[model samples]
Target: MIHVVFEKANVEALRKSFELDPSMDGEIAEVQDDFAVGPLADVDTEEGAAARLQWWKDILAGGHNEGLADDGHVDDQKVVRELKAKLDENPEEIVWIWAAQNKHDVSGYYWLMSQLTEYQGRIYILYLNNLPFINEKGNIFYPTNLFQIQPKEFVKAKKLARVITPSEFEVDPDEWTKLCNEDKGVRQLEGGKKLVSRGYDYYDNELLKFVTKEWQKGNKLLQQYFSKSKEITGDSYLLWRLKYLVEVGKIEMQGDWRNMKDFQVRLPGTNAEAAETTSAEASQS
Candidate 1:
């Protein structure tokens, strides 16, 4: 068995808790660039790879350079190549994909299925986005991914994995292409059978309001507010929006902008020149 997970955090969590059998392997296929809003093709050729990389570069460099790296890009070719090699090497090995309902995992799932059009190996999916599970305290919670479920609950999910039918894979290739080309945010696939990427930002305005309220009190880190909010999925996206706010003069920072730990938010008003001039008159300590 080879478990393919959609997020790096889920992979790490599973590795720490659930040990793979001696004959099993683990792979991560998270593109980390699904927020794109253009046509994208399956990364089976050099041309497709180049196109995806260029898209990533253009989007990241356009005013979002402070949060996400100016050149931060996902190597889709490497991930696809590795998965193909593994499937070809062991045609009988089962490929178990663990994905959630969110944009990241859902997009990755569709992309992987598109790549495995001619694969002979068996493929299974553990889509636990809407399933309910009990935690250690006996309270039921609907987890987004395997990372949130208890270790013992993972065993149950493994037992419930469903094999991907030939029809499902066949229908997904065209859907995948359509989804990649859509100029919207990737969220849920329409009708649970077709994939679509009509974008939505229902949480950004609320997140900005929450952060502004918190900033009025004192300094804060990205993690501090992220841990408290359940409205957003990707932390990087929120940070990117914050950096944009800073660039537009809606917010100001006193420390290194790249490091979230050093983030100290304030409204732009006081001039640095005035503060420098008054330094001698302030307390020395």
Candidate 2:
């Protein structure tokens, strides 16, 4: 059996869960790049691929963004090719794809399924976006992603895996095309309906406020403060916004922005004329 997850956290959690589950034996893999979070362009051609990669680079010009390196650290072509090879090699193996209902997982799920449209092996999906789980306090919660799922609960989800039908492959590919070509944001709703529409960043304002309030305490470690912030979705998106703030004189940081530990942030205009100096520097750059 081969398990595919969209993020490293899910991959690590699933790997740990499988290791602890004496009855389960298999390999786990992660799509290191978060396709749901970045530029959605036609990736079938070299020009489109280059444009997509450039978009990522522009977003991270001020910081070290994940999957932005041209050296192939987060190469989509390499990852997709590897997935194809894996599917080709394991013809009879059961391929389990775990995803959630959120934009990130759903988009990733769609992109990945599109890649496997021609695959002849068995494929199963455990989409837990709407599934309820009992928490330690006996409270029911519907987690948005596999990272939030308890290790023991994973085994339960395995039983609910549904086989991907041929018709599903046909229908989903069409939806993926719209999602890639259109400006509409990719969304997978209940019953597997893919909806594309204009989307907004729901976390931006809340995260900005959080950063402003936290700066009152003193200079902050970028990753540490963000880890404490519950509203933000992921590090990449948060850092991208943080870089914008740095440019607009809202946050101040020095050194390599990619190394969150080495970087620091404080409220703008709090230190003499630093905000003005920073803005001038940003403009010059």
Candidate 3:
């Protein structure tokens, strides 16, 4: 059996779980792309894939992850192909796709399941949606991501695995097709397996709400925003949006733009010198 997960953190957690119970041992595969954001138009095609890659490159061009290596989509396709080959090699083998109740995992599930229609019965899903799990502190809480669950709890999570239904195989791919056709920039989980689309600027207003007239370090601002906002996204993406806000004159920026720590941001029309002086005085106090 092969255990498929969506996040990097989940790979390690699942590996730990495997050690806890030898019966659940299997090869782990990670689908390394966040499909919840970005363009999905013709993503299955080479041209469309290239377009999406370019979009990410543009977003990271002048931001924190500017030079980060990113062949994620290509790697994900290879992972899927390898999974199919393994399944063909051994008819008795099965795939267990573990997903939490979040847009990232669900979007990845939709994207992955669409390609595995031929092996419907061989694929199983253990969706941890609205499910209770015991944490390391012996408290009961619901998790939105697989990595958040304790390794010991995963021994029980394995019980939730069920073969992918034929109805889901037919209906879910249609949903993926609709998402690709709509080509929206953001996708959100309404409930269960349902996803809703939103514009590229969906989080723009939320981000703006955290900005103050006083200058704040880029990293500090992002930390505060993440702690306060109900909706959270990758810091790289949020930093990219902050740079966009600066570009459009919605916010003012000071210092270097290359790194989050080197930059400071504030609402437009604020006195930069006064803000800096005030910040220095407050720090001293």
The top-ranked prediction according to TM-score is 3
> Per-residue lDDT for 64-83 in model 1, tens only?
24324344454555666777
- Sort all candidates by lDDT, best to worst: 3, 2, 1
Worst 10 residues of 3 by lDDT: 66-75
> Model 3 clash pairs?
none
**lDDT at 23, model 1:** 27
TM-scores, in order shown?
0.72, 0.73, 0.93
Question: How many clashing residue pairs are found in candidate 3?
Answer: 0
For model 3, residues 1-285, the per-residue Cα lDDT tens digits are 999999999999899998899999999999977899999999998898788888888887877677563644446888989999999999999999999999999999999999999998999999999999999899999999898888899999999999999999999999999998999899989999999999888889999999999889988898889899988778777877887898899998899868889999899867767789899999999
Alpha-carbon error at 110 in model 1, in Å?
Answer: 0.8
Q: What clash pairs does model 1 have?
A: 184-199, 185-199
Q: Write the number of the candidate with greater TM-score, choosing between 2 and 3.
A: 3
lDDT against true structure, model 1: 0.61
Please report the TM-score between candidate 1 and the true structure: 0.72
Which one wins by lDDT: 1 or 2? 2
Q: lDDT for each of the candidates?
A: 0.61, 0.68, 0.90
Clashing pairs in 2: none
Show the lowest summed lDDT stretch of 10 residues, model 2: 213-222
Clashing residue pair totals per candidate (backbone < 3 A) = 2, 0, 0
Q: Which residue segments of model 2 deviate by more than 4 Å?
A: 19-23, 64-68, 136-139, 184-203, 211-231, 245-285
